[model samples]
Target: MSPPYDLVCFDLDGTLVQGTVFIWQTLHDFFGTDGDRRRKAKDDFHAGRISYRQWFEHDLELLGEAGATRDLMLAAIAGVRPTPGGHQTLAVLREAGLGLAIISGSIDLVLHRHYGQVSFEEVLINHLSFDHRGALVGGTPTDFDVDRKGAGLLEIARRQQVDPKRVAFVGDNYNDVSAARAAGLAIAFNPRSEELVETADVVVEGDDLRGILPHLLDE
Candidate 1:
């Protein structure tokens, strides 16, 4: 039988990459950016005082002020690795002829660092830019973050000429709830919030990424 889904989109930080909850928060902690300032920017964004782009730029500015560089940022996440069995899972899914994508608010650097060898049909995440000297210059923030993650999923389905009901999304946190609800098959793997669990079609608790395979693949 054909696979139940044509495409699968994953959230990067906690879902695909282990040992990190949010890449932005991880960078802030690594660079010693002000917590108060970070929180304020975040609050302002959520309160509609600032656009998502503005909040993204503000965070990048904070990191730039702290002398963040591409090399340093890479080093900060050097110890972070893909979730256990994540590589194998992706390989299996690809072999099954399912399209793969990433819809996340995490930085592109993290994705490139860990899953660089892997190929994805689409990647919707923040892209960090650097100057010739490797200093943090600026970044391009994604529209598909937080509450908009569901929209990202739809965009992918549209681009692939597939019905939204043929898409599956796997994620692990509250931010992932929107996409989970949007997908035909939603798997909450190692979920961090009750909201996500409540929204998911399948909830698998474990560090192993392969735990989701049975739910996604036909027996």
Candidate 2:
């Protein structure tokens, strides 16, 4: 069977990486675990109060105090091995000629590890600024991506020169659900929250993202 869509967009954490967001895990290592905040975010996510962007942006801001640099974030992400089937599943999608995109709320340094590994043709993540000498100043990113996730998907489709109707997006958060639903088809993978699961055309409960494979094809 042919693939159901021409493009595939994926969220990094929970969707592909699974469990903790890379940055947060590092922060927890540095500052010690704060289960209260985690519970609060999860509760809010389930209660339809805050978005994945808000939860992530808040967590990042909390971690900003740790004085983590672009280098440190990269190191942390390297520690976060992708879910069991992430890379293989990605290879399958790329082989199918699907325009791949990584539309994530995470920092650029963390997502950059995906280069030459995951099938994403282009990635859109929060960028960090540094001096000419390459030291992280720990300031806010000039162009935050949360507000632009959906537009990023559209931009990818435009750049790939594929019809918007031919694109599919998958994720596990409410923020991603909006953009995913806007795509030709949306697959929610092992969603921690119900809002996003409800938005998806297909919801896979298994941690193995490869479960998403069948949904991508038109038998």
Candidate 3:
């Protein structure tokens, strides 16, 4: 039988990659950046006191002040690895002719660091800028993060010429609720939040990414 969905979008942290719930938090921890400041910025963004871009820029500024460089940031997340069966899952889905994309709040560095060889039709993530010496300079934040994740999913569907009902989304945290609700098939793999589990159509409890395959493909 044909696949149930035309496109599959994934969240980066905790979903595709293991060992980090949120890459931003990991970076802040590694750099010893101010936790209080980070929380304040996050609150401001949620409170409409700041835009997502402003919060992103503020985080980058904090990292830059702490002397973060491309190399160092990479080093900070060295322990992070792709989920078990992650590559296989992507490969199988690609082989099945399903469109694959990533809609994440995480940065590109983490994705490239682990799944650089894998290809996605669309990748919506933050971009970090660096100088010739590899020092962190500035960055572009994704608009489709947090509550906007669902919008990202819709955008991908529009671009792919697929109806939103023909798309699937896989995610783990509370932030994933919007996207999950927007998807035709929502799989909560190793979910970290009650909201996500409640929102998901199917829940896979494990570290292996292959667990989601049965829901996407005909057995």
Would you list the C-alpha lDDT of every candidate in the order shown? 0.94, 0.69, 0.94
Superposed on all Cα atoms, model 3 deviates from the true structure by an RMSD in Å of 0.8
lDDT tens per residue, model 3, 34-117? 999999999999999999999999999999999999999988999899999999999999999999999999999999988899
Compute each candidate's TM-score over C-alphas: 0.98, 0.74, 0.98
**lDDT per residue as tens, model 1, 1-219:** 989999999999989998789888889999999999999999999999999999999999999999999999998887689999999999999999999999999999999999999999999999999999999999899999999999999999999998989999999998999999899999999999899999999999987999999988898
List candidate 3 segments past 4 Å from native: none
lDDT of 1: 0.94
Q: Candidate 3: worst 10 consecutive residues by lDDT?
A: 111-120
**Could you tell me which 10 consecutive residues in candidate 1 have the lowest summed lDDT?**
73-82
Instruction: Sort the candidates on lDDT, descending order.
Output: 3, 1, 2
TM-score of predicted structure 3:
0.98
Error of 1 at 102 (Å): 0.3
User: Positional deviation of 84 in candidate 3, in angstroms?
Assistant: 0.8
Off by over 4 Å in 1: none
